[model samples]
Structure formats: C-alpha cells, structure tokens
Target: GLPKSMSVLRVNDLVLAAYDSGIRRLEPRNGYSPGQQDSQQFWSAGSSKCQGWDSQGDATYQVLVQEVNASAPQAEPYYMQILKTCELDDATGTVQIATRCSLNGEDVLHYRGDQNRWFSVHPAAWRVAERWNQAAEVFGAMNHLTPQQCQSWIQSSASFIAQQTAQPTGHMALVPRTEARPRRLICHVTGFYPRPIKVTWEQGEQDALWEQLSSGILPNGDHTFQIQVSIELGQEGAGPTEHVCVVRHSSLANTTLRVTWDSQPTVQTVTMEIVVGCLLTALGVGALGWYLRKK
Candidate 1:
C-alpha cells in the first residue's frame, strides 16, 4: 500500500498482478509503431482459421501503453494507442513509405520516405533509420526521468490535478527454482515508461552484489517497452539462500521481487531414511518384550 505521506502509481506489465493502490488499471490510448514500407508484420495464427504461419501478411501494427501517475501507487492506468498504416508502391519498383503516427487521434509525425533508383536513399531505408532514431531518443530520455519528476508534473498538469494518488498495496513473491545443474534466472520488467528504474538483487536490507552484466530495453511492438534484467543463480554446491529483485521508481514506492531457496529433494530423502531406521529398532524391542513375557 502507498504510505500516507507518499503517492502511488499502478503499473502494468501484463505479467499478471493485482494493483497495490486504489487506482483502477485502465488500458492505454495508443502504442502502435509507425508502419514503414518493406517492414514485415508478424502475427499469431488464429485457433482454427488460416493465415500464413506467423509472418505472412503485410504489416499492420498497433501500439498499447499503460502508465500510472507517480504519486499514487494504484491509480487508473493511462492508456495510449498508436495506429499506423504502411502504404507502398510495388508496381513501379519504387518504395514510397509513409507512417501516420497518431496518439488518440492526434498526429505526432507523418513518417515519410521514397526509395530512389539511383544514388538517393530509398524511402524505406530512410523511414527505418528515422524510426530507429526516434526509439533511441526515447531510450535516452528514460535515464533522466524519475518518479519525483512525475510527482512534480502531477501537481501542475490539468489531467492529473483531480487524480487520486495510488498507493503501493501489494508485492511480488518469488517462485523458487531448484535444480542440481547450473541455471540462470531472468526477469523482464513490464509497463514502465522512460525506463529510468534500476533493478538489482538485495539480501534483506543490504545491497547484494552479483556480477554486473548487460541490461537494455526492447520494443514489444505496441509502442510500450520491456526492460530485461538477467542474473546467474547458484554456483556448483554453493546454493543461494535468499535474493530479491528491487525496482526503484522516482515518485512511487519501490517494488520488490522476493524469493526463497527451494528445498532439496536429496535432503528430504535422507531424513526419511533416518525415520525408517528408528521405526525398525522400535519394532525389534517390542517383539523381544512380548517373547520374554510369554516365557
């Protein structure tokens, strides 16, 4: 739950969890990336009907974004939906690529490109580069934005002034994994924007340092982004006892992923053997007592 003094934000990654604050989670308005020419669209097959396996159709894309106000832990989710159309000219052997980028019926940019036959860059090529640059810019911005920044915006923004602050009402409990072989655990944080939050492992209250590895953001096709954090677990014979994944937000309370060690099957079997030995000894003594009484 959100503390009385602080605010709350209801974040959604679609991994499945309940809201901690009172804010209801609403779907976003837009998240579709601009559809550029020569860009492939991937789709999942329907249950019974036919379509080319996953990559058959021309690219038609939609973007979905779900954001929470920083001050409230459980607030209604802010929704953003981006719808894009990719128009191309295949008859003339030239690519005329145009992407109409809009948010809730509002235009952001009309990404346009033309594929030239001679030395000029193709429209598709240009559009691809442009889109990449835009995504890169967003990635850059994530580093600078924090929860506190969001809290400040909430106070002045017309959209947020009437909003209720959601509190951090719940937590994520870790599902333990046990195997003798070397295994790795990877978790991706979803429903975060500007990607400023930092993820790390902690033992109780203190910082637990593991090997520092690579971390980055990947597009989920729906304008929203997923941040992936990976860690190697338990070396040979040195089992890890406890670890937690902490997500630090600027304005909202931090989220913790708590995990405990799984019980070893081998240990359980050894304990069972000891119990069986004790039972056998007891039975033998009972038989001896009965025989002596009969004599």
Candidate 2:
C-alpha cells in the first residue's frame, strides 16, 4: 500500500547508505568508506544493526500504509517520506537535529528538537501529529541517539574528510581599456577547497590599498572553490607599472601565492610598430635616391 519509499544517510553532502522499501540498495557514488580501525568497527556495527532497523521500519510502514488507504481510498497513490537530519556548528559546538515527514512532496509533520513536540503542517494530518506527540518515547529516543550517532560518524569519517582539501591555482589578466571606464586588473583563483582564502593587490613591496572588489568564494562543479579580485588602475597611464596579486589559502605549501602583471606593450603592438618603421625607412630611402638622381 505504501508508495515508493527510499531513505538515505548522509554526512554533509556525501551519501553513506541508501535504502529502498527497507532493503539496502548499493550503487556506485562518491560515498565514504571507512579505512581506519575505529571507523571500520563503527561501520561494521552500524551495518549489522541496519537489518533489524529495516525490519522494524517495514512493519511501521505497513501500518501507516493501511491506515492511509482506509482513510482515503480515493487517493490511491500516497507517498510517505521521513527525513532525519543532524547539523553541527563546529565553531560553537552546537548540534541541531530535526525529524520531518512529507506526504506527496508536501510537508505534513515536523518534530521540534528544542521544544520536544511534534507539529502538523497540513490540517488533515493534525490528528496523526497529535498521536505522534502523545508517544513521546519514540521521538525522544531518536532525539537522544541522533547527536551521538552524528558525532560517531564524524569521527569515523575524519580521515576521508581531511582528504577533501584541494590546492588553488591563480591567474592575473588586464581588462581591456574602455573610453567610458578606466582599465582594471583581475586576479582569478580557482580549484581550491576548504573555502577560506584572502586575495589582495600589491605594488612594489607593499599592499596597493587601492579600491578593489571581490567575488566571494564560489563552489566549482568538481567540488572545489574559486574567487576573483579586481582593482582599478585609475589613470596609471601607458608607462610600465608593476602590480602583483597576492593569494593566501590553507591548501598552499607556504600558504601564499603571487601573480604579477605589468603594463608593457603587447607582442601585437610591438610587431605593428616594427612594420611601420620598416615601411617609413623604405619610403625615405626611395625619396632620397630620386632626389640624388634628379640632381
């Protein structure tokens, strides 16, 4: 009677396990696997207990399905989903847990971890929500176990988490000068992980302290991050002036990267100048030869 049901356990964005209809389903994905002894033991215990947990879940789902069918025979297809989430704030050492349920893509019930109460989102589910709230022991046990399970999972995945760090590559380019606006220099740092990074402009040996703008760190498709910093040239003129882009990130060996840009003539400009000079020289030589022959 239950419509298609699936459950997933995740840490941050990585999936640890997935189940469909109380049966474990395995597929290739960028999921975590335990390598350390402690992690291995934790994984083994959790996996071994999953079978019993699934059995209980199957029985509960059957009851819920039958109840729904009895109540609403017209709505033949019904979907019931349960989501349990535990979020941790590393800086504050705070953990927040939530238990939520949805029916046909609409939230129907939510458990308030702080207040220890279940609330109905849909009017029709008010009775069901009240019934759940009356059974405090069920949700209470889940609330108590969630934080411990999250911490254990975090500890088990520490090594794999650490391996997620990635180093960044940086580049510097000059924005084409325009009649309406001043020329600008842009520094792009890409393919980095663990987010926190600093980018600045430098002139000579010190910080430029010029007006600049930044595109805050953004995630890449490959799970890395990128950022861009740009500074106004402000009538620096055509003369050669050196500017440097300094980057600091944890992934770097020395935690620092520098890219330099100078206002020098481009290859195309230099080549054009050479061609013009040769043409002028040839014309001058021809004019002088004609003058001598006529004289």
Candidate 3:
C-alpha cells in the first residue's frame, strides 16, 4: 500500500496546481489544437485515485500530466484540464497511459482493461467541485492571478457552457484580484448580435444593488463585432446568494446568467468502524447473558 501521508501530499500538490492555475486551459500535449496553444499550460503530478497496491498484492502507481488554462488574451475562455493518468503495473512492470477519443460525438471506451486508463476529466464533470479541494486554496490567491489568467478562465467557461447549451455564446468568470468579504467575479459575455447591450444584476427575485456597466466594441475580423461589458459586484449580500446578470441584447432574448458564491463550510466528517473482534465479543456477551437467563 502507498503511505497515506504520501498520497495526501500528492493530492495536495495537484490541488495546489489547480488553485494556482485554473484547470480549464491546462491540457495534455496530445490530440489538441495548436490554435488553442496560445491559451493553455501543462503540469505533471501523481494520481491519488488508487494506491501503490492492489487486491492481488501487486504494486501499482499512476502519474498524470494535467493541462490547465494559462493566463492569457481573454480574462477567461473555455477552460479545461485533461489528465492522462499513467500506471505502472508491478506484475509486469509495464507503464501505460489511458487515452480517449470521440466517436461520432460520443466518448466510447475502446481499450482493454490491461491497456491503460487515463482518467479524462472536464471541469463540467460531476466530481469537479470535490476535485477542487486543493486547487481551491489558490482561488483565494486571486490577487496573484494575472490578467491573462482571468481572460483564460472567463473565455473558457463561456465557451464550454455555450457548447453544452448549443447557444454559441454566453459568459463566465475567473476569481478576481481583490480580498473583499464576498470575493470578486469578473465576467466576459459573448453573443452574435455584436451590438452594445445592457448588463444589470438581479438577486433572486429582488431588484439588484451595486450595479455598474461599461461597454466597448471589439472586432471579430469577420465583419462582425464583439461587444464586451464589465461590471463589478463589490457589495455585501452579493456573496452567500445567487445573483443573475440580465443581458438584454439588441436581437436575442433577455439572457439571464447566474452566479453564486457561498463560502464552503470548514467541517470534516469522521466515521468510527468497529473491528471484527469487537463485534464478535459483543455477540458472545449477548449469547452468554441469554444462556444465564435460561439457566
């Protein structure tokens, strides 16, 4: 078995990498678009999903190369982290890295169990929040995130969300560079109309407070315009609740993008398990008492 301490430390290191560098723009070196290279970076670490031991008394371990967003041109774009967890099988001492590909727009497993399994994860996946534990530490270091980093996160978040919704456009945020009580959120909104639009905030169903909007026109180089707006929610209550930015476009329906930042509670849960010996002892005592009563 792997030392628990070493496993924990390895996890911490990966999480720190996630925190210091948002996972989206980080990607693996293979099967990626070079055009997107201007936006991502790479990090290598060991995987914690399994230990150095298996049921058959074989030693096994994995190392992963993770690709995350680097600070770049946009504050944030479609961000992602691709992990290729490679394992060394002690039985054969063979090293293998998992690989995946899309077949007709669907991810299908094609390799053998013995081939290898690189756990490909997306920020949009289920375990993302939990996978974020160590990385969450750097999120608090938002002040250290450069403008390039912010651009990467926002742009990447927007792109990914849009792809999921098939909307072709939307907005997202990267942690901001200030230490306010509620945390800072910077967003970039994209759409097809390419005209100046109204950006305002509404909390839950109530009217919005702390509203500010700035607008500019960007060239798409395709005879189209890219409209950009910036607003800050530097106020109380903006934290610990859900806030929606209602973007009224010149041609599209009023699109409402929501953001929520409730502080994660700092509580750890522990479960106590009894040993088999203790269980047998309790059962023996119960039987003994029953026998004495009968006597």
Candidate 4:
C-alpha cells in the first residue's frame, strides 16, 4: 500500500526510485584551436563470443565510439584497423585497428590496416596511418593495447586533471562499519585539481593525533578527484567527537579548508530506536512476572 502523502510523488521520482533501489545507478562543438570550442569524446572497445570449440565456429568482436566536435588540431585523431585471414578456418586469425580524423561527426579519414599495410579514406592520411600501425594503437588491439588499456583513458584523464589542475575541498562524516567493528570518522576531499593533496583528521586546532586510514585518492570523473582519510574509533576514543577534515591542495595557496558535519536527525533516530527497544524489553519482563504470580 502506498502512503497518502506519497501520492504526490512525481512520475519521474517513482521511476528513479525503482532503479535506485536495485542500485541502478552530449557532445561539445568544434573549435578553431583545441581550446576554442568545448569538445566531448567517447571511446570504448571490447570482445564477445571469445571461445570457439571448433575451427568451423567463428567468434565475434567489436569496438564502437561516437564522437563530436573534434574539428581542428585534434581533428586528426590517429587511427588504424587490421583483419587477418587464412585459407583454412583452423589457421584463420583476425586483427582490427581503427583510428581517424573527424570534424563535426564527419569522417576526415578511416584507416583500416592489414598486416603492416594500411589504406585510408584520404590518401594523405596514409602517413598517419602508418605511424599508428607501427605503434599498434587500435581498438581492441591485443598486441598494442589491452581492453583495460583502451577503457582506462577516461579514468586516467580524471586522475590527470585532479593532479594537475584543481584545488581540494573537503568535509568529514561518521561512517558506521559493521556493528561488531569499530565505527570510523572519515575525511572526504574532492574536486581539487593537481591531485597532490592531503586530508587529515584533526581535533579542534591541534595537529592530528591519530594515524589516518589511507583510502587512496580516486577520480570524480569530471577532471576532478576525491579521497578519504579515516580513523577508527576505539573503546576509549580521544578528545572530541567533534572533528574536522583538514584539506590541503594546490587550489588553496597557504590555506587549508576544514569542514565538519552536522549532528542532525542521525542522533535523534538512534536515540529513538534505543528507547523503543528498552520499552519493549520492560513489557516482556512484566508479562513474565504476571504469569508466574497467577500460576
């Protein structure tokens, strides 16, 4: 049954909730120089139907990329494609490499290479094709680039931006581990470029007294970065439950950002649950005492 108040939910909210419960969780224009216009790029490559029990069986593979707004300097994105074949099926193997120059979604050239030889949509692109072939940069190019390597560019790009371009911003949160394990206080720092950054847990203004549980820096996927520094709460925790996520990054020159979390409904909710449990236990004990007295 739905709640009466929940009837007000917008259609979009219901649809999103369904996906979120299961944990479900375009391009830029062309430019004169690489910097003039915003550009968006996507590249993905993978293989399917890898196992073939017999020579008569053929496996399938592919790589697909849809790109927009790469018109100038970067207009020539090096590309090469290769396919291998033999007279007998048992002896047959295939190679595919594709790289190209593009403008406004139009192909400047598509270079498909076989062996060391290459052919291009534009004859002048042959030289670039040869270079890509020699370097063996291809979609799903097992020899030159691995599937992991092909897909890692996006993540690496984020890491690069975090380490080279932005500054760090941060805050702290209470992270409750398993009930049996120690709860931890975490300092989260994100969105600073030039990822050479540090986050420490501090009490008041004094230097951090406890060792940080290193939660390595990770990319936030928008040319930004994030990292977590944590400390486990022991039986006899030190100083204040009040703490700070001390942030240090290139963006903040001679400055550190210290952020704190609110003690909100989280405290109220826990207290309420404890009170309810205690009340239920008292009722049970009273019921048992009455039963014994009646007997």
Candidate 5:
C-alpha cells in the first residue's frame, strides 16, 4: 500500500523538477487519489497523436535516450523515454518515463506487473517519478543516457514517428490480486503507428471519472510502439460494471476497448439470492409449524 500523504508530496517534487528544467507553464501530475494507483497520473499534458501536424503545438515536448550499450555482451539498444501526457481533461501537465533493453526487435527487459508502471498515471508516480526513477536510471546508466543521448533519441523518435504508420492496439484486463495486494486493471497498447497515444481509463462510457497515463513510446523491434496503463482495484463493491480503456491515436481516433473485472455479484443476482433465501426460510418455518401441530 502507498503512504497516503506522499503522492501529493511527490507531485510537488516533480513540479519543482519541471520548474527547474525551464518548463514555465508545463504542468505534470496524474489524477491523485490516496493510495489508489488507478486514480493517479503523471502531471503533464500533451498528445502523442499527430493530427496531420508536425508538432502538437506548445503542449508537447520530448526527452529521450537511445544509445547502444557499449559494455553489453550482446548487441542491443538501451533506451529511456519521457513524455508529457495529456488527456480528455483540461488539466495543466504531467510527465511520463520508461526504460527498456531491447535486442533484435524484442524487449529483453520490459516493465510489467507490480514493477509494471509505464505510461502510468496508473501506478504510483511517487515511487518512480523522482530522479526519473532510479531503476530506469540504472538501466540507462549503462547505456549512457546522457543529455546528448537523450537528444539523439528524441530526434530519432520524432523521425521514426513521422515516417511510420504504427497504430497502437490495446488490451484491457483486471489482474487478479496477489498476496493480499489489490487487483489491477491494466490496459496494454501496442503496435501503434507513430507512438503518440492517449490511453485513458474510463468508468461507464467515458463518464466523469477518467485517467490519463503515458508509456513514453518505446520501440517494438519491428519499428512499432508499445505502452501501458495500470491501476489498483481498491475494495470494489461488485462495482463499476462498465469499464473501458480508450486509446486515442492518430490512426484510430478515440478508439475504445471495454474492460471488466471478474464475475462480481450483480444486482439482479443479489436479488435472486435474497428471494431464494426468503423462500427457504418460509419453507422451514412452515415445516416447523406442522411438526408442532402433530406433536
């Protein structure tokens, strides 16, 4: 479980980082809900989708590191990516970060599960948002994700996205709880053209509750892009029959994929159970009365 007080504190810290980085108006944060992973988001704003425009105006910026690991025993591209995430809401901004070690078009190390926070605004950002997350830094440290390296990756990602047609395909699921941890609903999007995508977790047909996350656009070895969002299912009360993972990409605008939790007791089912219980109770009473009369 996350410390309730720290998520906002962490947000303040990242805010300071962005401010120090010369981003005057760029805001960063996910929807902050105490101890709930899904309710959180990276506090930046922008769109990855290229709507026939070379850039996403002033809302978008990029920092990336794509350098070959000079010391790796095998050939691979070690990459670290960061992006400002935007969503359906009119919030200010939030940043997203991700790292990977890919070889021959496949990720030798892909972040998933509890450690699975990418494009998150899904998982807690406080844990990783600081110092670009030490884990990611450690991975990038070997590859030398210096400012120069990041600049190269930024240029490469822009060039690749410009010339590519990879559109993100998303998979949504509720992961079962493990060892008392809450279950997480994860939306994994992959194979997208041009990498800039808006993955939103929506409740009931894009209702008032929605979350925006960033996967920071990483390569799939096939010249494609992949990203993900995850949130913890907190003490749900047979809840939220309607859940969806909405993927807005340049190729498929506002594309949505509905997701559901495991079989929860529906209202109809609960009513039926109550009715059966009452009938059984009545039958038992009737039998007891008849026996008393016979006695």
Candidate 6:
C-alpha cells in the first residue's frame, strides 16, 4: 500500500485544522472559529469518530485534549507540532504508525505505537513525556486511529490524487560562456507537479554522454517543481548539431516531451550582418552612378 500521512500545523498559540498529505483537508477561517458549513461538518465528523473510538475503551479522548492543554507552556514564543505517519509493509502485511511531537523546532517526545508507550526524545523532556504518557487516551488513538484514518483517506481521495498531477513545460536555450567556462546548452523544465521527473540531454538518436550539470528538482512557491540540466559546448565540434532536452514525468507518461536546441545566429549577430550588407549595397550603387555620370 502507498504511504499515507497527516499533519496539523500551528503557529504560536493559534491552532489550525489538519491536512491530508500536503493538501489542506480541513481548516477554519479563524482560530477554532466556525468556517464554511462543509468545513464544520468535516470537523464534527472527525470529532464524532474520536468519540466513537473513546467509547470502545475505558480511556476517553477528552483526557488527551485536557492533557495537551495543561501541558502547554505559558511562555511566549512557544511552538508545538504533532506529526503522524503510517506506512504499510506489503511483504509482512503489517502497518506501522509513527507519531512525534516537537517544541520550538526541537524534537521533544515520540510515541511508539507498537510498544504502546511514549518516550522523551531528550533527557530534558523526560518529565514532560512522562506526564503526557499518563494519559492512556493519547497513545491508544495514536496507535489505532491513525492507521485507519490514513487508509480511509487514501481510498476516498484516490481520484482526487490522480487529478493533481501537473504536466511540465520545457525549453532549451544557449547561454553565453564566462571567461573560465565554455558555452552551454541549458534545458529547463518547470511548473510540474509530483516532483519526480527526468530531464536528460540527448543528441539526435542517443543520450548525450557529455559532461553535464544539473540544478536538482526544486519546489516552486505554487507547490509545483522545476529543474534544469545543462551541457557545456566545446570548441572542437565541427558544425552545429541538433540537441534535445527530453522530459519524462507521470503527467506525460504517454508521450516524451522534447525541446530542441541548435547553433543559431544571435540577434545582435544578425542585426550587424544586415547593417553591413546595407552599407555595402549603398557604396556599390553610388560607385555605379558616378561611373555612369563620368561616361
């Protein structure tokens, strides 16, 4: 099964709702304030599910909430985080739930669902971890509720996930060389989703085996990805050769996207040639007119 995860983001004292994977699944307009009707419905559903889980055992989920509120520090500039991840081992038919907490960018506590225990990540956090572990409600939910939520969300969002992929756009350009480097042919692919993509330089029918450099896949502000692969152009090449940049991505699985680049005259070079040709033609016509006048 594919790995699944959920994250709740908080900044300072304001608590926001959770997200499935990276998509914003549920969030309120203001801190704990009622948002849209659908968002409230979703939150209510999750709360009811928690209550149902609490009914199955002696520990109530409210204990976990109260413990969290009581454990929060009163100091300013405080930060808290909770991350839950679930992974399935296909070979053993086993699922693992990993839950952890951080404070002020430092790991403070972690829960071992397999062992049914919460442990301090550092010696300084031992007291805090021990205090929180006393609330059996938290660990039980971390152990059982997380995997179920992960699986159910994945199944329900399968079609939505498939529609999320964004196809990449690619282009090729010849860049001027520096004093220490040779000219380069750069292939850039951008605005792609899912991040996993292949950008390679090819010469005619085969992969270009020349020395190349790559700007590894980088995230765009809009959540898409981009990459650039470049190969140095050597002076030893006899003539212009057609080179192509090939991009392979899940969004373009059915077709390979290619952007081609070849040696072409620069705009300045073409402009200079046209100016010189015009000047030569003017000089030749003037000379012919003078000879005809002399005749």
Instruction: Give the TM-score of each candidate.
Output: 0.29, 0.53, 0.26, 0.36, 0.32, 0.55
Tens-place lDDT digits, model 6, residues 272-295: 643554455455434323221222
Q: What is the lDDT of candidate 6?
A: 0.57
Q: Write down the lDDT that model 4 would get.
A: 0.41
Query: Model 5, range 110-219, lDDT digits (tens) per residue?
Result: 23222433322312222333334455433332222233433433433343234446556555545566987766666666776554667766665544243344545443
Minimum summed lDDT over a 10-residue window in model 4 is located at 7-16
Considering TM-score, where higher is better, how would the candidates rank from best to worst? 6, 2, 4, 5, 1, 3
Superposed Cα deviation of residue 31, candidate 1 (Å): 12
Error of 5 at 42 (Å): 43
**Alpha-carbon deviation at 52 in model 4, angstroms:** 29
- Would you list the C-alpha lDDT of every candidate in the order shown? 0.33, 0.62, 0.32, 0.41, 0.39, 0.57
**Mind giving the per-residue lDDT tens digits that candidate 3 earns over 43-119?**
23222122211211121111110122221123432311112233444476454433232211223222223422222
Q: Which ten residues in a row have the lowest lDDT in candidate 3?
A: 56-65
lDDT of 6 at 127: 64
Write down the worst ten-residue block by lDDT for model 1: 42-51
Cα shift from native, residue 250, model 5 (Å): 0.7
Each prediction's total of clashing residue pairs, residues at least 3 apart in sequence or on different chains, is 43, 0, 31, 17, 30, 0
Number of the predicted model whose TM-score against the real structure is largest: 6
- Residue 128 lDDT, candidate 4, scale 0-100: 45
- Name the regions of candidate 5 deviating beyond 4 angstroms: 1-163, 207-216, 238-241, 254-295
lDDT of each residue in 72-175, candidate 1, tens digit only: 23344332222222222336433333333222332333433343111113222334335544562422211222334334322223232222222211122222
Please give the distance, in angstroms, between residue 211's alpha carbon in candidate 2 and its true position after superposition. 2.4
Model 1 regions more than 4 Å off: 1-182, 203-206, 212-215, 219-224, 254-295
Question: Residue 151 lDDT in model 2?
Answer: 72
